[model samples]
Target chain A: MLHELQSGFMAAVLTGSQTELTSVTPKIREGKLNTAQRVAIYRRNVQSTLRGALGDIFPTTRWMLGDDKFLNVGDQFILHAPSTSGDLNQFGRSFPEFLSAMQPSAAADMAALDWAWHEAFHAAEQAALDLSRLGAVPAEQHAALVFQLHPSARLIGSAYPLLELWQAHQNSEEAPLEISKILPADHHFLAVHRDDANVTLTPLSAPQFHFLKICAEHQPLGEAAEAAFALDANFALQAFLIQTVQQNIVIDFNEPS
Target chain B: MSPHHQSSRPPHALDPLCAGIGLRPPHYQALLGKPAAVGFLEIHSENFFGAGGPPRRYLDKFREDYAISAHGVGLSLGSADRLNPAHLENLKKLIDWLQPSLVSDHLCWVGVNGRYLNDLLPIPYTEESLKHVASHIRQTQDYLSRQMLVENVSSYLEFADSTIPEWDFLREVAQQTGCGILLDVNNIYVNSINHGFDAMQYLDAMQGADIGEIHLAGFQDTGEILIDTHGAAVSDAVWALYASAINRFGAIPTLIEWDTDIPTLDVLLAEAEKANVMLEQASFAMPTREGRRHAT
Candidate 1:
């Protein structure tokens, strides 16, 4: 009896179709509330719960799109996506992707950037770089050295002036901020990490960015350095490496080729 | 590292007699060097779901001084999809590392297809949901190789198609799965008030032996609705219901949860102290009533 009832109720909740309820059990309508109303309540509850998750993950995106439209997108996301975790903290991984494909008036790139940044904020904590190993390496092999970014670090590049735009939006009420002054035609690199229990983001240079990327890929030291140089010939390998090392951005090291 | 290494397992710190508080970020610093006595601490497992960081580091220090319970918020036990393997792996890792006294999750599903709602959404109290939830719980226990306490969530709505009462559904789940019950007395009280069910009757229907833990938290009576916000002190009426619960299930390990609008650590400790007093009174208050009733 328990099995039969759970299946029928799940069927109704899953499909939101009156026919499913009737087919599973005719007694669904016998309660104080009709089957439709009960199922509607569940539907409302489910959507609202999903909405709350999206709101948390994409606060900026929701702010960009009005609440009503944000809710409409939320409803669509719920229909397309079902929750997989019991934890609300883990709920919005796919939301940025959902917003990218969504027809909302906001720029897709802006939404995607916001989502990436949010993920970096919630990403796991890891130990800072090991300085002793890298310091032992010979200066002659410095160019061959590649740096590994912390596991929690993420590098995001956006075509839109997303970094500047995001900053401008935050300062909108206090004073009018202009993105045109800071906007660059070339892509801008952003590094994300948790510092002091807070997620921090800062722009990165070509050498620093590529070096970390290669290390993240776990490419050996020699190969990672080559990649960094490929991104920019004047990569200033020593200068950036010193700054990254001091910042404790690298968690581990390898032999200088 | 595998969780089954017996030598590495941490000893349990939970005391059967005292009350504990759920540890949150707001109170981390306050709890760091406090001399006050707290039975143990419980945390939302997902809060430390990240691979490593300050949260894990702080929890490690806290565990050294206080017993810990890992209460999970994301193990969607009732979902029909095969249990999430990634989620299971993460949980397994946490249990192995933390070695908490009690590992618990809700008897609810928040995700339907793939995206997670993150809230403890209601599961229909029908045999199908029951069997599915039970089998999932059994599998979870088998994987973890430990009995998990499944807590009931507060629900604002019930399915018109639900064939069994919520308590019965809960009972069948615990009985069939061989999992212990983490009875959230506050949730029961809130549901009872919202759904117009007799809280005592619900308590009467439960199997006392299977109950492993009790949760007490305040609710939001938003005038139009009663939400289980867990944001304030437990209400007077809810405390009465809790006192009744103690009469039925003597001296279960109780936790005071304050998630939103969380107050000071002292305030939570004070609230937990209140639960401890009630817990003591319940045990002492019981034999007298039992003897009087038998005299009749």
Candidate 2:
């Protein structure tokens, strides 16, 4: 009975369906406010709280779409895809995909990048790669070693220059770059990660991005390097490896199984 | 009643007489490196639920200077559905790492049927709901190997099928589960106005109850009803009620909670200072008992 009551109440608040309200309204007491008004308060609370959470997580996307449009989309998203986790941080993972489905735009790409930054911000802290361990491994056997990115590291590919867009919105003193001025690119690869306190977004070249992507798939160093070389003949694997390690991107490694 | 296991790490004890403030992210930098004026800092447990990030990193730094209270918002302990195991695991991990002086969540449910509404929704006051919530609390206390305090939530509506008073329901839940009560004085005042109940009666019911901590927050009077917004200062009426609570319950650890429209750290400390004044007055007016009481 409690389950039925809660299910009916949740359904009414989330969807505002007449049938669900019929099950819940009779069980709610009416005072200064009528039963419909009382239930409406909950409906407003549920909508605003979840909408506020999305706005917090995707402020840039909200800004891009403006308040009215963003609120509308957020409400629709809340109705269509209610949160599944008690943790609010775990909510809104699929907003980008939802936005893309509703209407593809630069805002959806920005949402993807925003989600990545969010994930990186909360991702697990891991130790940097042990230089000594790598040093002891024979140079001839280095090709067979499979490297892993930091747990906080996320590789995001988008058609828009998301980092610039995010940076532009961050500085309030300067006017935000007009979305109309920016054009879609062939591809934009970025590595979003948290190194200590800062969550940094690093732009990556086609070759470097593919190399890291391959490495993430648990490919051996030799194979990853070959893929990068395929993307560009002069791909600098040694330099990129040094930079990756220095930036705390590639955190651990294991011998290929 | 269930027995609680010893904490893996020794937790920093909060001075129960001194008032504390909620640790919001905006104040993280300003409160850092400075000696906190409050006795402890209360954090929403779900905020630090992330594996490792700025939230945990900052809490680690602040832990050195202030006692910590892990006030969770996402447990949905009163839901008819089963307790979220992942949520419990994450909460346990945070507790183990922080070793907070106090742990608390609401008596309200935030979700049902695996779909989280993410707001503190009210549950009916009845025998069945009481038993369900008590069992959930027992399960939680068992899993974490530590006793937890359950707070009363501010509600806009009351169920018609309710048999027990909200105060009685809360007290019975505490009695049944051997848990402490995180008495939100503001919620009592707000609900009193919203539901047309005597505020003094609510406090009277809580007399001799396991009142672990007191929360003082602001509310919005929307002409028709008072909403527990926690976005402003401690209202004059709520402050008066808090004084009465201290008189009745003695000097419990009180916290100033301001979630929305968060002001400067100095402003929050000022609010904490106000609660501290009441707590101090209570200590002097009455013979103070040992503030710390084990739930079991």
TM-scores for all candidates? Answer: 0.81, 0.95
Question: Please, what are the lDDT tens digits per residue for candidate 2 over residues A136-172?
Answer: 8889999999999988888988888887777778875
For residue B92, model 2's alpha carbon misses the true position, in angstroms, by: 0.6
Worst 10 residues of 1 chain A by lDDT: A173-182
Query: B1-296, model 2: which lDDT tens digit per residue?
Result: 01122235577777767889999889877888567578999999998888787777787778777889999999999899999999999999889878999999999999999999999999999999999999999999999988899999999999988999999999999988999999999999999999999999998888555988999999999999888888999999999999888877678899999999999998998888877777777777764466442122
Report the C-alpha lDDT of model 1 over B1-296, residue by residue, as the tens digit. 22112226564656655889998888888888873468888999987776555667687677768888999978889876668888888888778778888999999975655545566767777777887898889889999989999999997666555789999989988889889899999999888877888999889988778888899999888554468878889999989988888877677788999987889888988898898888777767664432112221
| lDDT value for model 1 | 0.72
Q: Check candidate 2 and list the clashing pairs.
A: none
Instruction: Tell me the lDDT of model 2 at A205.
Output: 95
Chain A TM-scores, candidates in order? 0.78, 0.93
